[model samples]
Target: MRLIKPVEITPAKLISSNVPETDYPAWLVSATYALGDRVLLDHTIYEALAAVAAGVKPGEEVVTPEAPAKWQNRGMDNRWRMFDDKVESLTTNPGTIEVRIRPGAVINSMALFNLQGKSVTITMIDPVEGEVYRKTLTLVDAGVTNWYDWFFEPIGKRTDVVVLDMPPYGSADIVLIIDAGAELAAIGHTVIGAVKRIGTALYGTSVGINDYSRKSTDEFGNTIVVQRSFSNRAEFDVTLDTSEVTRVRRLLAELRATPVVWIGEESYEATILFGFYKDFQIVFSGPTVSDCSITVEGVI
Candidate 1:
């Protein structure tokens, strides 16, 4: 069957320290009636757990079923009456139903449903008290789309410890329908620690500066060094005149540095030169030359 929605689960609140009874409910013990009849309880404990995990809040209503019933043949008056009666009976008398919350914990939401073609029951045994809350539901041939939904009460102030059991059926399947909210709640707890750590780190580093660095090493294990220095005031124009000027130009181009020439105020411009290496002579002959420094950067 396809799941239409996700389950919700929330933290359960502690109600009492006393444990429940030990006996399993009669409905839970004998899932099938005489003549091979099936009794189905629409919801399961696992589904309730899932709802709680998904964040179903207290006082929220969720529907469950008592057993699976046929949905077709609703036009028959007798079938309709049977269906209505069964729904009312199950809703009114959830025999010996009790919710026990574990101490210091939260109570998640509950799940209820009907099982098709199977007799089912629920028995909760509080290990501490050895008391059991037993419940039984019979399967009926109700029309399709007319199944009953059971609403669980709010996870009030008094609930501690929960134990549930279901009897085996020879020919019917027992399915657990859960609440979307409770499922999420259960998963959230599993990763809560990691989420908290990441949140802390993000908050702590919000105002810090981030530094970036890059380095290259040669085959001989020697590291290429590049440096940049800024100079203010002195300026000179240098033109290469030697035969090795081309090689020097190539080397300069490979150095990965920008060359800047400062003219009169508001007339400054920069150019990138490259492809020079070995035996290059640059002649400096500029009227605005007195004392200037060359800044070099990048891997050599």
Candidate 2:
């Protein structure tokens, strides 16, 4: 029942990057905009909502009372899609994509979802001690069960990566690098935060994906299928000290609608999730121990 309470990495925190933030033209305060016109501002795309809007700065939303509703936010720009919290929207680049961050606050864990790269390199530098941590991970899964799969099947790449061993240093500058050799490098969503251990994930834990594809049958018994993305889901029980019951209740209360990296057991990859929970309950049957059951739903 361990989880990551991620800290929001504002756009300003992304101090440097190899990728450019030029998906659309920069918003001009003097330029005139017609209805449905789009411009980029602060790495976000905003669409003009008026027939003709001039000297109106584009922002995250239509400022009410403060300014006229001239622009409506569409979504993140192409280069900023990975930090948008939506796993289906990918941030892509050729050969490699690199970003540097100074979180200021201490962060010990980082989770990568929907990755499309051959390898990843993470480097951390302390202000006084210099290079503190460096690790490179190959993205392919090497475990093969059968001879046919080993010879005939293409190499399987694990899209999800969880790094739970970062040194807890607030001043360390962390650099994330994704390499795809000669092909494209892409990432869907990334989570960097500190971990919170709730309890152990007992047996009978379940993991699956919720499909959103459309299926219809014609009168003649023919089937039509419209493929769609899916969201990963999981349910598990936890065992924690009875004294932490109040703390767990409060933590869940604060993270109700917020999305965080949920890591049930560090050794179990399927137990990790980055999403919200629909419902949870706590039960106490003894004086020294308590139990918790939580159901989590992930964002695509």
Candidate 3:
């Protein structure tokens, strides 16, 4: 199986020196502002120049009709910095991937994405504190597919590991994408087995009367009969236009314990069939068409 490139997200800290408070009240659109009254707007700091009826937004360098440009920007060159902590390509190497965690860093949430769109078992080991967090993520698609499949929100955990490796718990298969609308011509490996009858049926029907009764006599020694309810089962025959007896037999065997869903038709609980009986019969009809009649039963 082919392992694709991995992506990771890491938290970044913002550092600033001699930073002033930008938490002043926002400048209203049509409010009177006095000179030297500071206001914050759009992540910029602005100050009023003269007593006017509007127009003083923090950090704006424009002189609009609503407010004359009387704003002063008090921000450093690099006050906020975002980190490039996406770890990719390292996951393709299995256990060779390692990530460093800074000391005294707070981690409230942690999420890992497995874009393979398949079920995988993983064992995560924190080598520093020797703590193990084990959990199985469901079917995860790739980044472009099901990107946000696995996550540990509000983990409230801390780790001091200098390096961490993510290896497979056992064996994992790489998931591949396939188009449901693709025709047989586009799919070179597509095999058109047969145009057989495919439908759903239930082994039994839902019951409403179960020990349902009403008192007819006031005598304490009166005898009563319990009502029994039964479920309606679905039964149909699938006739294939193929002469492959062995293939028909194998198909019948797989349908015995497999759940089948059939919808759209107006029947009693149309698509609620659980499975079919293991016993099946196949009859030869002519030289090509064969009759493989099987009972698709209800679950309940």
Q: What TM-score against the true fold does each predicted structure earn?
A: 0.15, 0.92, 0.25
Best candidate, lDDT? 2
True-structure RMSD, every candidate: 34.3, 2.5, 27.2
Off by over 4 Å in 2: 34-36, 60-70
**Could you say which candidate leads in TM-score?**
2
Candidate 1 segments exceeding 4 Å error: 1-110, 141-300
For model 2, give the 10-residue run with minimal summed lDDT. 52-61
Give residue 225's lDDT in candidate 1 (0 to 100): 51
Model 3 residue-pair collision total = 14
> Model 1 — which ten-residue stretch has the worst lDDT?
190-199
Model 1 quality (TM-score): 0.15
lDDT of 2 by residue, 1-300 (tens): 678877677877887888887777889877898888888988889888786556667753456687677778888987788889998899999999899888888888888888998999998889899999999989988678999889998888878888888889888888999999999999998788888888888898899999999999999999999999999999988888999999999999999999999988766778888899999989996899998999999998
Candidate 2 Cα lDDT to native = 0.86
Query: Using alpha carbons, what is the TM-score of model 2?
Result: 0.92
Better of 1 and 2 by lDDT: 2
Error of 2 at 85 (Å): 1.5
